[model samples]
Target chain A: MSTRPLALLLLALACTLRPAEDHVRLDERVGRAETPDTLVLEEDGLAAIREATPRGARLWAASPVLHLRLRTAGGPFELVVRNTLRDATLTLDDGTVIEREPGGLPTEARFVLDLPAGVERTARLAPPDADAAGSFHVAVLSDVQDAIGEVQDIYERMRADPSLRFVVSTGDLTDSGTRAQLVRFQEELETLPIPLYSTVGNHEVPGPEAWHDLFGPFNAFFRFRGVAFSLVDSSTATVDPALRRERLRPWLEAHRDAPHLFLTHVPILDASGLRSGAFRSRNEAASLLQELADAEVDALFFGHVHSYYAYSLAGIESYIAGGGGAIEEELDGIGRHYLRVEVDGARGVLGVGLVRVD
Target chain B: MTRRHGRRAQVTAHLLLALVAAGLPAARVAAQAPRTDPSADAPAEPPPPEAEPPRCSRARRRAAPALALTAGLLLHGTGHLLACERRTGRRLLAAEGLGFGALVLGGGGIALTGASRKTVAPFATLAILGVGTFAASWLADLYGTLSGGANAGRPARAAPFELALGYRYVHDPQFAYGHGLHLAAEGWLHRTRLFGGAWLALDDDTQRATAGLSQRLLGARGRGDALDAEAALHGQRFGTDGFRTLGVDVLLRGRLELAHLGPTLAGSFVEAEVGLGLQGFGYDATGRGVREDWNGLLLGRVGWGVFLGPSGELVAYYDHRRDDLAGGLSVDSVASGVLGHFGLAGRGYIRDGRWGLAGELELGSALVVGLSVLHRGAAPREGGAR
Candidate 1:
């Protein structure tokens, strides 16, 4: 009779002590800005970040900071800044308050907004706007986590292909949702010669709100070659219902006929976008996939179980790109591989291939 | 649940922040030094970075090695139990010798597993492997017992093979002999831990035989026999170290045998053991042996030990046996010992798939030791940590 409580107490103590080794903290610097580099914006410095980008750059609306890889006639320098909704007027040291266009940047022959004198700012070209003429193809990689070497190899090979445009990641970039894991994921992504646009996956969202707050608008969308590339957050688990039928269904339907692909962290069914599984529940996943299928979506890409599975259900080709990440479960006989798509005017044909850097 | 999750999140965030902050000083130090390109070195270079020397106060550095030694010693108390059977002759000693050899070579596996920078993957693997080895050793013991003396030294021939080797020895003026070697292998068959092995022995007297069989049992703890032949009852008392076992071995064994015991002794023994325990000993029909005039032996088993793994535990057990001699002379010797075991094991994907490692230590008057590595399921070519 007395043993029960003692056992409970021991269990409680064990549980508390279990995670100590994992909680090792080596130092104390985070969130605090260091050094006044023209590239590194201190708090909410929109002008500095923009000054770092080209004159007419169309940026992600919710992006908090603009990362600039400064390239001069001499060499290259790197800069970064926190750009919020607030606008800022870029002025040279000689009082040149450059007349900047208000919204929707123009594409060709964009001016290089030189930094204030005495402040050596590195300049990098931002992604060209959708209005730019030529259509390009993005890899749309998803869920590339701990398998750093393999993912890096894939990135390098993709970089070598001139036909390939910038890369788009459909989130779940880490396995344990740890900062180190996220950082390593970012480090691997940084090796790409082209730019990368990413959306959050279920694994990326440590909590419903915390990670979203840290990485804003994790569930959002963008346009490439006038085609709608929606980064919809289909994860109903461990998150708030920012994805409502009234919000997503109509938007998806509106862009259904467009030459577009839906990029998400969950899979959708053919009938409805409602997730349902006894052992593994994707209640919202079912609804999303169903909606895509009903809409005749071209391609659906996602990852979760670290497997490579492709299903052509209801006229939609669904590909699981989880092989780029940790293989927690069996890879379902598909050794780690990546997808390279050729997107012309309309049809997007994906070719799965090996990344030979090992 | 929310609170727990919140706490977990908060703790994770704080810890991450702290790690980044701590790394800052080093980053700053690096910044201060020459900005050497990390990629300048080749990838195949044997360890890109040496383990940082303990850089603390003199007292701290001194304390670090002491702490490490203390931890090693503490873990040592839970070393491998290579011999868990009675010192039937000298088999237990030989098994211990092999176990020691494995320990020296085996510690490298633990070091390599521990040295991995990936946090979750390595420790998770270690914990799993440790737990698994602990379980495997126990299971092997049970399987060996169930299969009887016939299946003693052969390893299971299948995918994900696991192996164990043990030797024991005892020397006394009266007995003057005891030594045996045992080897067993296990593998996955329809998701069940199935195994087989062979055992060999050379005693001081001149009794030698080779036996082997295969068995399948619940993970590491099971009772019963492969085939039931005789039904007899017997009780016995056995003591070793600081323990004693008083129980009856209810056995029914009917088989053939061939032996040449020189001119004085040469014959076969067929018998069955039965009864409630050692206190209650009795005999029944179905009996034959070289010492026809004398009766059999009553036996009990007792052993205890501490395990070194996460589930490290102190286990003790007792058993008794009786054998009827054909001649007037009857010999009954009690055997007992303590065993301590430490282990590390886990399941994960290496080279992008599933793999696992298991290791254990057994120590006592009678000891047995084993180590096994396994990989199963399809592996993703890409590798990672979770």
Candidate 2:
């Protein structure tokens, strides 16, 4: 009947038009340019180019390292990079040194470069000692909702740790995830001496469309030193099937032989199933854990419950660090804190120690 | 199954059976209670005067259902006790105690084991059965107080055989499939029911199929009041996602006629099922060709329904499994992980009970709507009349 065909057509249209807002777009957007003057990101990392022109560009880098390509007109050009780790190094193609200007915000790294007109050059910006990779320390923090005013103290404490490379987060950088709240959270980050890479949390669902533009992406993968870090979005308590297939499978495969640390906004399975601060589907969670185990991931980190927990899931070391001044879990002596994880290129994860800020 | 697993399964099965059996005899007695006084046939001798049974006050009768909605919701039998159905009330309360015991033991086991794959299935099964029994007792208590012992012992019958073909629409932002063809067939063989169904996507390669057999454990076949033990095999392929799953589950399902509880509940029934399963997922992508994983599934369902005429019924249900196409609801809180989906479904005959229409709506992370045209064979001669 005519009705059946009409119904089929409507179904097709609905399926085609379903909102596909997920982290996969961020993966595809990197290393792509809309115009010749636009900066092109090359690595599987999280960064956003805020402004681009013929002579200069300003960018925000959430990941510790950025591999980019850009074209510039002849003469001196100013490249301002914000939200970068301390002691970042900028170099031209194949290690040509470019010094950063002094006396800027501790989290900002400003570079001035001179180049020939109409020439495109590759640029690599990273920590000075990133490649040495014997053993390094990184801090993990999350759940700063409602506590944005007090998060700076935790950052200050991390700044005091000279060995900490950068901070990684599971999400909940803001209480409401509004653009204004996100911007305010970013403003507070200016005081930190290190960069923070994060996935979005459930708090961000109210404004899901805004987070991609502000935080780079909900799901991203990057390699630092010798460790592979994959940040996935479980803010909705489930991963989009397309994301699981298109991005996660490949990321896990690519890092199968390396030391991989998986981070997400929600734990795949709550430890006791009492709090249920985990994925909506236990079957999906168990399947994912099996995959992680099969891939031999080194560790997993999550933040949602406002407390600290260290446990093993599917034989992988896991931790939940949500002590960023949110409503604290009552009765527990511990308060605001973060995790300091040490990993070695050859030896895998060495230790994860809890650093209390309150 | 291994020896240890078999032993655990036996233990879990015994626990569930004990909980269910606690209410079985009482239900049977209530069902078989005499509808008419046999003494009418006796010679008319001067009847000995007997003290009338204490009557429920009008105020107490009015308050019974309200109490069921409040205190009885948690205590499981307050309303029945208030209505002076002390024997049934005590049985319900005892059932609730056993249910809570199973819940504690199963939940404690899962917590202590960290939900380890080796021991999760039996523990989860026990827990689901516990929750189902607990809820059923509460519902029974409410029905007993509200129905007022009217229209006692009426039975509802189901068609002995049926075949259906239908169209299904699914809307999920996470996947690409939208349209599907639904096919199902079910028939009774003596005291057992055999059933199979499939959902094939028209716009994508997604396909799912399930086949099962259920044996009547108590009550008569084709009757509303029955207990069944079912074993089913399930398979699904998510072509858009390049993954497939295969699994098997064993469930104990029961449907109790509400008329046994009270008159207002006549022609209505309550159903509950609890089960456990294990599923294996395999990926079809290039790098994931060798990638496979397994998961333990805890399945539970509870429903309340009313019979339509002699061969049709409408039901509203809550399903606690997430592996189906409907999946679990997505929310910003942990409750998303703890709860599943709710659904409404109905079936009715139009052509002398040989042809019928069926429809369903399910609400979860996705929305699923389905409508079917069905044909049924002749009903069995015995047990076909209501």
Candidate 3:
């Protein structure tokens, strides 16, 4: 055989092996975004700076924690952060507290910082109540596809609960992942009392790559009060093989000894195999489950099936809570609901409660 | 272009390239061989000599193809019945019915059990078998309808033993393996057939091997159409990925001669198999030392093919399993979640049946292409009739 065909085949293989752009863009925006001549903002997790200026910055904290380093010429600065729990507080490295002012939106928190000229001062912002090694509650919601209009009521219900720290979603935040729809979803989040972290779902694939641009990273990890949360992108029914090997495996390994909760848009193995609302390959699913089992993950959460299911796989507690008011799966009798998961730093998941909105 | 469109274009281009590559050799063989009745070289036992049967009219023959293309595609065997092959039609229909029954039972079991891993092996096996039988019957119906009726000549039987050596190319985005050396051997002794194969990746440190034995349950092994009960053991080591797997399976496999369905379907055959297996995956690089986990595996295959001369055959098949190298598709549709991989394979002997050439292509989560040279220990035997 001529080497020409072999060379062409190799070229084609190389071209095809290129990773998905969504993951690349996501990796780029995870840690920090910079604005020249202004303060440099750094986040411990998958947060994004929607707007940045010399005096202040608008932040979307995908995770509950943010670390900001100011490079100002000794003056007062204002910082506005969104998607944070109600009890969030800002404190200087010297242990001085910075009181939060009432922002324009209920979910927003504004803090004034006085910085010494030519000296970079670091500030830590986080929910103080969730920082301890005690049990806390978090709300889980997903699949608000066409129900974007009706999600406010769900958030209202969440807001009424004083015990809930924040919300985490498995994805499908809009009917389509269009920029307008994503912005609308974020706008509605202003009604909620706490932050909502999410991974993208299959429904988000159709519209151009606006989900990541608007909502930060599709894959992320964070720790709240000692409990580890890992969110992965299964929007296309399969995680990119590279992502699984390089990102997911490391995330699992890093939190192997902690009380880790894994969340993704699609279930790795659908409890009801008939619907197959899960990974594209059962082998892949099996492999992933084995990895999780080896790591001793506390629980798995997923949303895509439009109904709720609580099942166990590989000895780990798993739940599918897709009841965010999308078209319902009829006759199941459960609709428009979210899960209230309680976790402790010292212990694993305490319990998962189902909260119905309608 | 958009990413989706780009990916589609790439897949289409590769598919076309594979088609052209596969067609060239087959086309060359076709041109070299004489244009004669395909049944003259059928690899099945000949029917006992009998009085001449009335031939169907041209319109009836044409109608069979039409029916097969239309209703027969869904209602398998309708075309065979229309062509007056009552026994074969009824058998095909029975197979279809049994397939559906198995599907229902298996699906219901899976749902009832909540797809629990404990009891999933048997149910999944049934489901895979059901799907394979259903599809194979339909394809068989189409083949029987299109093949022109020819004399049911006995021709020659299959070689008793064969050895093959080959090279395989695999393109999987998940792995770095690109080239593999393949070796295989199979032999028949009395009523049993034993086969073994190995694939060693040349570019990466991955190796896989499979060994199997099948006991003939019905029909003659020499005729190349039989019902077999098989047991197989397979193992693979992904040296670069720090993992390995070992599995064993038992299957009930059958190959039916389409000529038995009708003389018009001479020289063609359909095969179906379903099985269950247990596999253990061992990981070497986890936080905890080496860890091993087990999972249930469902295996199934269905194919349609035609005999090539007296000792060769070409087949197109669907393999409903993901544990192998081809794995499963990673598409953006629900099919990615449910469907398996597709493949095409062919082998033909030359140089007085002492040497042969084989080629294969598989499409799944990966694309695999392989070509091999075969050496036969014995030439096909002649003078046998059913």
Question: What is the Cα-based TM-score of model 2?
Answer: 0.64
Chain B TM-scores of the candidates: 0.24, 0.73, 0.75
Question: For residues B131-225, could you state the per-residue lDDT of candidate 2 as single tens digits?
Answer: 76677667777766776555233333556788999999987766678999999999888778999999999998889999999998776666477
List the candidate 1 regions with Cα displacement exceeding 4 Å.
A1-129, A132-135, A149-151, A207-210, A234-242, A269-279, A282-285, A328-333, A348-358, B1-386
Give one digit per residue, the lDDT tens place, for model 3 in A234-258. Answer: 7766677777777778888888878
TM-score of chain A of each: 0.58, 0.90, 0.90
Kindly indicate the candidate among 2 and 3 with the higher TM-score: 3
After aligning candidate 1 to the native by TM-score, how far in Å is the CA of A121 from where it should be?
24
State the lDDT of candidate 3 residue by residue for B43-160, as single tens digits. 3443432232367566876798689779987677788778776555655666666565566566545544434445555776677777666776777777777764452333235567
Error of 2 at A129 (Å): 2.6
Residue pairs with backbone atoms closer than 3 Å in model 2 (clashes): B150-B263
- Identify the CAPRI category of the predicted complex in candidate 2: incorrect
For this target, which candidate reaches the highest DockQ against the unseen true structure?
A: 3
Ten contiguous residues with the weakest lDDT in model 3 chain A: A13-22
* Location of the lowest summed lDDT over 10 successive residues in candidate 2 chain A: A13-22
